[model samples]
Target: MTAVPEERVDRFATARQIADAVLLEGYVLYPYRASAAKNRLRWQFGVLVPPGYGRDAAEHSHQRTECLMEPRRGDRLAVELRFLHARRRTVQRAVGSRAFETVEELALADRVLVPWDEGVEERIELTFPVDELAAGEVVRAVRLAAGEEQETVQEDGRPVGRLLRRHEQVDAVLRLSVQEVPGPYGTLRLTAVVENTSDWRPPAGAGRDAALARSLVSAHLLLGLERGRFLSATDPPEWAREAAAECRNEHTWPVLAGGDGRADVLLSSPIILEDHPQVAPESPGELYDATEIDEILALRTAALTDREKREARGTDPRAGAVIDLADSMPPEVLERLHGAVRALRDVTGAPADPADGQPWWDPGGDPGVDPDRDRVQVGEHSVGAGSRVLLKPGRRRTDAQDLFLHGRTALVEAVLHDVDGSVHLAVTIEGDPGADLWRAQGRFRYFQPDEVEPLEEP
Candidate 1:
C-alpha cells in the first residue's frame, strides 16, 4: 500500500481548504420577516455548502455547517433558518400578508429558493402568473411599496421629477442549484425574486447581490462570536475572552461590603453584563457559526498523527474533550461537592436567623465559613458546573506519577446527604469499555466549609 501523507504537511492550506469545505456544507439565508407595518418588505436568500457533503450526515454534527439570520429594524427585515437537506431537487414556497408576524411565514407561500453545492453557476425563470387584474396590481403594489426612489434627468435639461423605484429585488424565478453538482471550489448561491401579480414590468436593476453582500457583512461583523450552539460565555476560550475584553476594561468582582457582614454582592459593570452574551451568541444562528469554527478545529485536530501529537504535546496538548468529572467519582463524593456549591450559590440569600443563617451549615461558625456561594473556592481556584479539576491522592497514599486508574479525571458531579446527615456524593468518571471499565466510587470530607482542602483519594 502507498504511504500515508504527513499530518503537518500543508497545515495552513489544509486548514483553509477544510475551512472552505466546512463553509460549503452549511448555508446562510435571508428569509423575509413580514413587516408589522403595511407595505413594509425586505427579502433575500443565499446558500453555502459546507466542506463535507453526505446523504446520511447530520447538519448539526459539524458545528461549521451552521447559519444565523436576524431582522434589523426598518421596513427591512431578515430571518435565518437552517436547511438539513439541500442536494435533492425540490421547490418550497412561503407566503404572508399583513396579518403574519414574521417574514418567514410569508416565504412559505410566496417565495421559493433552491440550494446547491456545486461551483457551477445556474439560474432559472420563475413565472408567477397574476391572471386576476386586481390581485396582480396588489402584488406589484406590495413589491413597489418596499422600493426606494431614484432621480433621472429629463431631455429638456432640467432635473425631472424623481420616480419611485423599487429596489432591484432579484425577482429571479430560478436560483443556483449546487446541491447535486460538485465543483473545484465550494458553492455559494444567492437568489431573489420580485414576482408581479399585476401587469407591470418587474423593477429594473434591483440587485439581490447588494442585499446579500450587506447580509454577509452583517453576519460576520455582528455575529463574530455568537456562533456556536454549545458555546458558552460565562467561561469562554482565551481568544473569545480577549476579543470581548477589547469592548471594555471593567471586570466582574464578587464583593462583601457591609460592616454588618450579612450583605454580599456579585457586581460587574453594565457593559460586562450586556456584552458578555455576545461572546457566546446563544441564538441558533450565532451558535452555528461558533460551532463551525469548533468543528473545523476538531477536524483539523483529528487529522493529527501520533507523531504530531507527541511532538506537539510540549506546546499544544489537546484538552482531550470535556470530561464530566462529576460522573466518574462516587455518589457520596458528588454529594459533598454539590453541598459545597449549593451552599455557595445561596450564601448571601441565607435567612437572617443567625442560629439558622449564614454559618448554620458551617458547623465551625464564622472562622470556617466561606461567604461566597456561587462556586467552591479552594484556595486560589474555584470550582463550578463547568470546572475541570484533577484529583490526586492526599495524605494516605504516595506515588511518583498520578495513576490514570479510571482512565480519566474525577469530577465533582453532585453532593448529597442522608436524613441522618451522613454525606454521600454522586461522582462521574470516564469508564473504560475495553477493560470492562465502569465508574469508581470514593468518599470526601470538607474539614471546613469555607476553606478548600485536598480530598484523600480513596
Candidate 2:
C-alpha cells in the first residue's frame, strides 16, 4: 500500500465516517433490538452470498463498479473494501457434569443471553500505480476462514450454561482493469470487481439464512487518488458525459466522496447517494440505521420501557449502546437534533441578515409572492395552486425511481420561482391517500415549467 500523506489521511477519516454509516445502515432499525420484526431482516445492503446457495433474487455472488478518472504519470490509487462478517451465536444448557444440550436462551445471575447473529467488521486495502492498472488487470485474493468461539456461564463456580458462535469460510477475488476513455481529453475508465469465489456449497434445498452465513455483509468500496482526479458517476462534466454514460456499473454505483468538491476519492456503494455526501454534523452518534430519521429513532428508543430496554441490552452490544445513548442524551442535545438553520439566503441568492431581513423570510408577508395563489406560465396556459398538470420529468433523471411518475396526473400545490427566474411546479399525485400528509409536510415533487402540461377542466 502507498503511504498516504497526513492531509490525505484526514480526508480518509472524513470518508470513513460516512462509510461506517453505510456499512450499518440497516443493521438494526427503530427500537434497536432483535425482537423488532424489521431488525430480523437486517443486513439489507451489499451482501454477496456463496455460489450455489444464492438462488434467490435478493442474494448475489458478486458486485462491480466502473468509474472514470484523470491520472498523470506516477499517480497512484488506493482501494479499500469494507464489509461485515456474520457470527452465528447460540446458547447451551448444562445437562450433566461434562455434557451440555443446545438451548435457545441462557439466563445467569447477572444477565440473560439470547442467541443472535452478530457482525464483525472486516477491511481489505490495496494500492496500485496508474500505469500498473492501465497496463493490465490487477487481481488479489480475499479470504476469511471458518471459525468457532465459545464462552462459559457459571453460578457460584458451577457451570450452568455456555454460548457458541460460529462462521463459515469465505473466499473472494478482487480484480481491477483500466482503459483510456475515447475523447479529445486524456481520461481513463477503471473497472473494479469483487466476486464471491468461495467454493462452499450449501445442502440441497437450504434456506437464505444458510446462504447468508458465508456472505459478505454490507460490503462497499472506498477509492483514493494520490495525484489524480476521479469524475462523478452521478453527475459528470459536459465533455465526459458521453464517456460516463458508457461506463457499466453493476449492483453498486460510485459517487464523489472526498468532500468540499474534491475529486480525489470515490465511494462506490450499494445504497444510492449524491456526490460528496456527508454525515450530518449535528447527529448525536451512529444509530446504525441511516435510512430512518435520527431524531425519531432517538425519541422512540428513549420511550422504551425498562423491561424492553433490558431485552435490547441483552440482544447485542450495539443495541445496548443505543439504549444507553438515548438514556444519557440531555434536553439541549435533543433540541439540536430537532433541527438547525444552516444559513439565511435572500431571493437574490445572497446571504441575508436575520436581524433586519426577517420580513423577507416570510413569503406570505411579501405581496409579490403567494405560494397558494401564485401562477406560472406553462405552455400556452397558466397553472396555479388549484390547477392540475401532467408530470413529465426531465430526460436526465437524477433518481431513476422518479420515472414512475412520468405521464402521471398531479395536482399543482404551488408554482415556484427561484433566483434564476426559472419556474417550477410543485405537485402531488392525484388520488393518493397520503397526499394530504405529504402536503402538510410541504413535501412535493418539483418539475420545470416545460415539464408540466396544464390539464383541461372536467
Candidate 3:
C-alpha cells in the first residue's frame, strides 16, 4: 500500500484519543440501567457471531478489532488486549410429564434455563501479554480453553439424567495479531480477535445476544515513539480536540503522549469497528443523545413546583439567583417572564405550569422603584460586598481548570456588570493563596450572577 504523507500524522493522535474515549465507555450509557429499553442493546461496535445461530449451537464465535498505529523508527509498540470471558451455564428441566423418558430425548426436548446461580461459576477476565512488537513485523498470540463437565439434571440430590460434557476440549480461543504496515512514516496496524470457541448459544433475540456481546471486553494499545510526538488538546487542530475536552463528563481522556518526544504515546482505548448511526458525528463518544438537552430541560420544567423552586433558591446558588432576578419585577412582568420560560419548555415538550397555583414569579404587589438600578437578589439576599456565596456546579467553566471550588463558600468583594448587562461577582476565598496568583496566574475565580447563591447572614 502507498504510504500516507507526514502531515497526516497529527490526525493519528487525535483519532486515537477519540477512539480511546469510545473504548473506555464503549458499553456505558446515560441513566445506566440494564432494564432501560434503550440500554438493553449495549454493544454497538465490532460484534462477531459463530457460524450457526443461537448461543449454544455455535461451536465458536470470533470478533476482531483493528486500528491503524504509527510509531517512529527504533521505537517499540506495546499492544494489550483486555476482555471478559463469560461462561453461561444451561440448566435443563423436563417440560412434559414423562418419568421414564430416555436421557437423549429428554436432553434434546427439555427447556433450557440460563440463570445466574450463586457459587455456580466465576467469569474469566482475559488479558494478553503486552507485546512490544517492532515496526513492520507481525506478532500473534492465542489462548485455548478446556471445557468442563456439567450435570443435565438432579432430582432431590440424585442424578436423574445422564452426564453431559459440552465442548469437552478447546472450549474457547482468543487471538491477538499485530502487523506493521510498510508506510512513509513507520506505521503499524494492530488487530485483536476474540473467539468464543465454546458450544454455548445464548437465547436469540431476547437481549441476551446483546448482553453476551458486551461481555467481550475492551482493549488498549500503548506505542513507544522516537522521532514523532503526540498532539495535546491545547495545540492546533482545535476541531480534533474540542469534542474530547467538552465531553469530559461522558468520556475519559487518558494522557496519550507526554511533552517530551521520547515518551510512549498510549492509545489506551478499544477500537470500535461497528457503525453507530445514533451517535452524532461531531460527538461520537457522547454517552447521551444530542437531543438529551431538550429532554432534560423538559423534565426540569415539568417537575417545577413552588416548594421545589423555593427549596432550590434556598439551597442551589444558580436557581436562587435567577429566581431573585424574577422576584424583583412587577406581577405582570413576572407573568411574562414565567410565560417565556413556559413557552420554551413547551417547545421542548416539558410541562410549563408551576406546581403551585400561583405564577412562577409573584412579586407580591411590587413597590414602585427603578428596576434597572436595583441590585439582584439571590434568595432574599442581594449580590453585594461581604455577602457569602456558594458556587454552582453546572456553570459554564473554562477548560484546563478543575472544579475545585464548586459548592464552596466565598466572600464577594464586588458586584460588577458587563457591557452585555450580565452580572459578575469578584470574590475571595478565606484561605486563598494570594492576590498576585489570583490576578497573574488566573487562580482567582469569577462567577456569573446566576452561578452563585447569596447566603443569609449569621
Candidate 4:
C-alpha cells in the first residue's frame, strides 16, 4: 500500500483575454442624470492608453467609442469602449471586458478600483448627438486625466455588494443644454438634455471624492451599479390602492351606466379620460380633476362583460344603465343623476310607491317588484311604482314640452319589461335655467295591477 502525497494546484492562463487586448485609448468619462442637476459630481472618468499607442488611432482610426450601461443594485453606471461595425446598432461589438463575457457575467466579475494621478490635468471634451439631449433627461461628460494609481486595489479578490471605493475628487466645468421630447403615449413629451463643464466629485459614501472621481473613469465604471430603474413613475406605489378605496365609497349608489357612442369611448385603448366625453360634474370646469373620471373609467373597463356591446336597436329599457351606453350622456347629467338619487334616498329614508298597486314602504309588497333588485332606491324613488306627482315640462325645456306633446322622447328615461309583460322606467332630464322653470323627467312604467310585485333593495 503506497501513501499518496496531498498537493494543491491552481489554474492560470498566460494568454490575455481578447477584451484586455484592446487598448485603452486615452481617458474615460461619465455623465450624471439630468434630475441631479444641483450636484457637483456630474462627470467623472479616467484615461488609460495602451503602453505603445500613438496619435494615429485618434485621427485616422476606424474605431468609434460608445457608452455601455449595465444594471446594479439601485442604479446603472457608464462604461466605455471601441464600437465594432455591425448590421444593427444593438449588434455592435462590445469593448474592453464586455468583449470576453456576457453583461451579467461582466457585472458580477471582481471589481478593480481605478487608479488616479493628481499631478497631471486629465481632461477630455465629448460632444453628444443633438437628438440625445433633452430637458427631462440630462447628460454630463467627465474628463479623466492620465496619471498614476489613484486608489489601492481591493484586498478581497471576489466582488462584493459595494464594489468601488472613492479615492479623490476630479472636478471639471460643464456646459449643459436641454430640449423637450414627445413621450410614448401622446402629445405629452419628456425633456432630454446634455451638459458639459462639471465639477466632478465621487458618488456618495465613496471615501475620497477626488480618488473616487478618478477611479470612476475605468472602461468598466458603474459595473457595480444597478441598471435603468424607473423610480419616479411609481412613487409610493400604494397610493394607487388608497385611491381605489376612495372611489368605491363615493360611487357606491346608481353606479354610472354607459350611454350611446359611449361604448367605444369607454373601451378605447389607452383609456385617457381627457379625450372622452365630459361625464363628471367637476369636468368642463377644471382640467385636473380627473381622479373620479379615472375611477369611473376603471369601473367601466372592468365591467366590460359582453364582447359585442348591445347597441341602441329599438328602445331597450335597461340600456340607459348599461356601462357601454352611458358614454354619450354628458358627465354633468350623470353627476346630477347620482346626486338626485342620493338626495332622494336621504330625503325619503323609505321606498317610493310602485306603479302597480302595493304598499310603497313595504319591502315585501306586490310580486311585480324584482327579487334580484339590481334597481334600488337611492332616496325615496321607485320606477315601477306610479307617482301621484305630475311632472310638467318646463318653460325653458321647449324640447321636453315638444317631446311630451308630440310623444317623441319618453318622459321616463330608463325602464324594465318583466317576464309578464309589465313595464317600469326611470327618468332624468336637463333642468330649466331657473328652479321654477326647471324641466324634469321621472321613471315610469305600466304594469298589470294584479301582477305587481314588491321591490327589494339591491
lDDT of each: 0.24, 0.83, 0.41, 0.25
Instruction: Give the lowest summed-lDDT range of ten residues in model 1.
Output: 216-225
Candidate 2 Cα deviation (angstroms), residue 445? 17
RMSD, one per candidate, in order? 26.8, 6.9, 22.6, 29.3
Evaluate model 3: give its TM-score.
0.31
- CA shift at 141, candidate 2, in angstroms? 1.6
List TM-scores for all candidates, in order. Answer: 0.18, 0.75, 0.31, 0.15
Which candidate wins on TM-score? 2
Q: Give the Cα RMSD of candidate 1.
A: 26.8
**Which pairs of residues collide in candidate 2?**
none
Best by lDDT: 2
- Segments in model 3 whose C-alpha atoms lie over 4 Å from true places: 1-34, 47-74, 84-207, 210-458
Q: What ranking emerges by TM-score with the best candidate at the front? A: 2, 3, 1, 4
Model 4: residue 329 alpha-carbon error in angstroms? 35
Indicate the worst ten consecutive residues by lDDT in candidate 3. 112-121
lDDT of 4 at 365: 42
The superposed Cα distance between candidate 1 and the true structure at residue 197, in angstroms, equals 12
Backbone clashes (count) for model 2: 0
Cα-based lDDT at residue 311, candidate 1: 27
Q: Which scores higher on TM-score, 1 or 4?
A: 1
Per-residue alpha-carbon lDDT of model 3 for 1-458, expressed as tens digits?
Answer: 12433433442444344444444342423332222356444444323343333554322255444434454555433333333333333444444553423322222222212221111112222322224443233434333353556654655665555433332122334444556444454444545444544444445454444335323333333333444443332331344343324322111123344322323443433332221112223221233232244234333433545544443342223334433443343445333333222234222333334554533332222332222334667766676766778876444553434267777788776655543456667777756668546645544457777778777663
